[model samples]
Target chain A: MCDSCGCDLASNNHSHDTDSRIIEVHQSLLAANDAMAARNKAHFEAMGAVAINMISSPGSGKTTLLEKTIERLKKKIRIGVIEGDIETDRDAQRIRAKGVPVIQLTTGGACHLDAAQVHKGIHLLEKEPGGARLDLLFIENVGNLVCPATFDLGEHQRVVLVSVPEGPDKPAKYPKAFISSQIFLITKTDLLPYFDFPVTEARREALHLNPRLQVMALSATSGEGFEAWISYLEGLTGKTRKDNFPPLLSQS
Target chain B: MHEMSLVQALLTQLTSLAAEHDKKKVITVTLTIGPLSGVVIDSFQFGFDILSAESNLTKGARLIITSPTVSYHCVRCGSIQTAAMRPDHCPECSETLLIAEGGDAIILNQVEME
Candidate 1:
């Protein structure tokens, strides 16, 4: 039924009920997720956490990088994690083993973690030990590169990782991840000798698509070119590391 | 798929809109899907066709989708170019770096319900 429009010319008083009227609704379909993401950002900022959302293909060494980063920054920065996976709490368990608060978010059959799920994860994380206070909070998104890039999880920065073995064609194929990400991390550089991955081409293509992307390469296993990564992390929190290590960013 | 979730959100919004307008049935729905929105148009239409049929309020509703052109601001020449697809280079200055503006939207524009 439509709102009654007075038109005495119409003999039938109920004519409006049969007419289909168009209603203007200029609203984004992601309004719900974005609103929740804003709230999640506020929550993270209130807790003094620099949140980073990590996106990459499975086996891109996301958890490995995190494990190493936790070991390196735990003493200097109060770190926490929120691990997202399609199933199982395996990644969360690994992060928790490092003696820091970590929350596991299983998306069941869903391909990506939405803002509503991350909102719940944030509240659940605060219930864990030392979760309420942190300098950096890492939200390890689902391993799929495509779907995760479409959703925002209320992180301050978005980091997209592509391992050396995954090849450098990733940027060209999955442009959304590279275009949407702030920092692009090239992982598993230790295997560069064995793999024919042209690291420079990868960085070039990503930069061509997104000129502002900060690209860095490192191997979490060998710690080669890892200091820059750590310094980048420290710079995010802006001189908040408790270790008070001299800033290594001037050289980076 | 994220498309399914998005279709679900659309359906929910449609239901609320119908209730708000005191309408019994939805006739048509219009939406805008941007090229860089990361949403596959086919998957979204498939999801809408399947999910909307399950709800009485939106059953048999016709879905119309339009893709709006995006303006890519050339980083070199500072010229803005609008296109349905992301261009490889700036047409004016021949620069490869162009920051895309708009065209990342997935919005519900209009609906007819009675």
Candidate 2:
């Protein structure tokens, strides 16, 4: 037997048949998506925008959080949104009502938004009024925890959110989402009294999955524990509380 | 499942490989799916079984899949352990916060054609 190619034919007497051969091609299946994601990252940087990808299950208050965030930061920062959904432009419509440049990407039944879809969404968003230049871009991924965590959309940061009603076991049940995300936001905290969710246990589980995860719990409705989230956004945009308002006393 | 999408990608890759090498049929395709790749092996195989039948080039193609073990490093003791699933705690230090490394790739290793 031929030892080189592990063929049944003898090495010295085997015919040089190109018909049969083994090709060694070691490459990642997600390489194409990753390359496009890199290009999307460069495009975002070129526009001087910090893009964030938000992942969560449906009804996790992702849209509500964004609405409140835009209300708070629109005066100081230019915000845009790319909303992904399996069907329906409702989320985009809601974001548009906030007076920001927002585009809706209907995935056509796909569970997750890949980098290519986000690239198209970026171009469409740029065509909208006040979209050409922005300080931040929020890509609201299709509301599914398992699939979105597998695809990179060229975002600067990834945030995985779970609502108090969704329970604290999300991190344990969906390990990939928690493991890949940099931030874990527990939304709808005002329902704590009505729900049995334990914030500490949720944070601890998420931290166990990813030690570097920044976990924060907030209620957009009650405005509870929201200051930290706003400050974190300001930090990402390289702005401070003073930047949004005049200094109390001038240094000069 | 996204495994169907990945299977479609694999079929595309196989079609191109056949054209590039002037082969008539694909005999075997080998893949290495890591424990943390977020891909279900059974789903991927089911996808392959259904999709590969649509084309003559990849029909009856044998798929060989191997999953690599993930390595977890103890945060307290710095000891490393490899397992197919996440270990409950560090064997050396009883620490529960072990950091995982690698084992998150879906790689197309090799293809045999005739």
Candidate 3:
């Protein structure tokens, strides 16, 4: 201690000055991230896109749901996707095949995608055709229920998905995602007859955590309870049903 | 993990702090992680311990974390209750329309350097 910077080592004999100074910083560690998120939100609104952040456990059918949604509304609403994963361009590839602009943000090992990452993602997506102008943007967050719940990626809405195989205890177990989200969509309801996932208990638990959450159940494979979802999207975008879509899009 | 990202953010802040303060080394860092902040304390500490050792300025810096309780005010009765854990039902009126208030912050309170 005495050799490094000429500091006293246990000097108590009438010290002339107290060198220790305490600085009070009442600033948040997340302030930087939040600031970036605010910028991203402004950028999204400027682009006239309603961004939705999707959170769920791994294999909760986020990709499948996106595929179905793109199939239904690709002709009407111009959709763009930003896929966040620990490692993969796979989800982005799927969305790209649907003829919509898509970007992948691989977090390497991080469990979540923050605003900074999305800020970069948006810039990258703009390079693709039709990416510059989007009616709706879907940010598929990394497949983790816990960590991804913490960060906000400047989304207009947050939708938490739960598959039938994930069980009804998800809401009770992962309260942070449900509590923070505005919408909770129960996916893979086609398998409800096989699994013992009680819709009532799941809805009740989520409601207990967040009474304001709008809950919906749908089966993407069976096409059951899909009208509500389709209507919700149409209502969100204020897009009236057109007379006809030009016999378009033979899926690749 | 999310904690690793947070640790990375902390290290970034520390590096800038050391440069700004013209310090050779950091002695201590104080942080406030809220209960509902979605950060696991042990994981964050583990990340900090490992990551901090990699840097010269913060190789031996001590980390102190504090979690403040969140207050919930009932919309029905307007009674406020403070709890680290979410209340199952409102203590005063048994109402479920309780809004969260404060304590949702992850802050770097202070950094001591020399």
lDDT winner between candidates 1 and 3: 1
Ranking by lDDT: 2, 1, 3
Number of the top DockQ candidate: 1
Report the Cα lDDT for residue A43, model 1: 94
Worst 10 residues of 1 chain B by lDDT: B84-93
* Model 2 CA lDDT for position A172: 88
Which stretches in model 1 have alpha-carbon errors above 4 Å? A1-19, A240-252
| Candidate 3 structure quality by residue, lDDT tens digits, B21-109 | 67778878999998878788999999999999997888998999999999988878999999988888898899986777777678999
Q: TM-score of the second chain in each model? A: 0.96, 0.95, 0.96
Query: Global CA lDDT of candidate 2, please?
Result: 0.91
Worst 10 residues of 3 chain B by lDDT: B96-105
TM-score, each model?
0.92, 0.92, 0.90
**Model 3 bad stretches (over 4 Å):** A1-19, A241-252
Best-to-worst DockQ order: 1, 2, 3
For candidate 2, what is the DockQ-based docking class? Answer: medium
Calculate DockQ per candidate and list them.
0.80, 0.78, 0.62
Which digits, one per residue and each the tens of the lDDT, describe model 1 over residues A1-252? 223565555444453655577899999999988999999999999999999999999999999899888888777789999999999999999888888999999999898999999999999999998999999999999998898998888999999999999999999888888889999999999999999899999998999878999999999887888888998999998854455554333212
| Candidate 1: pairs in clash | none
lDDT of 3: 0.86
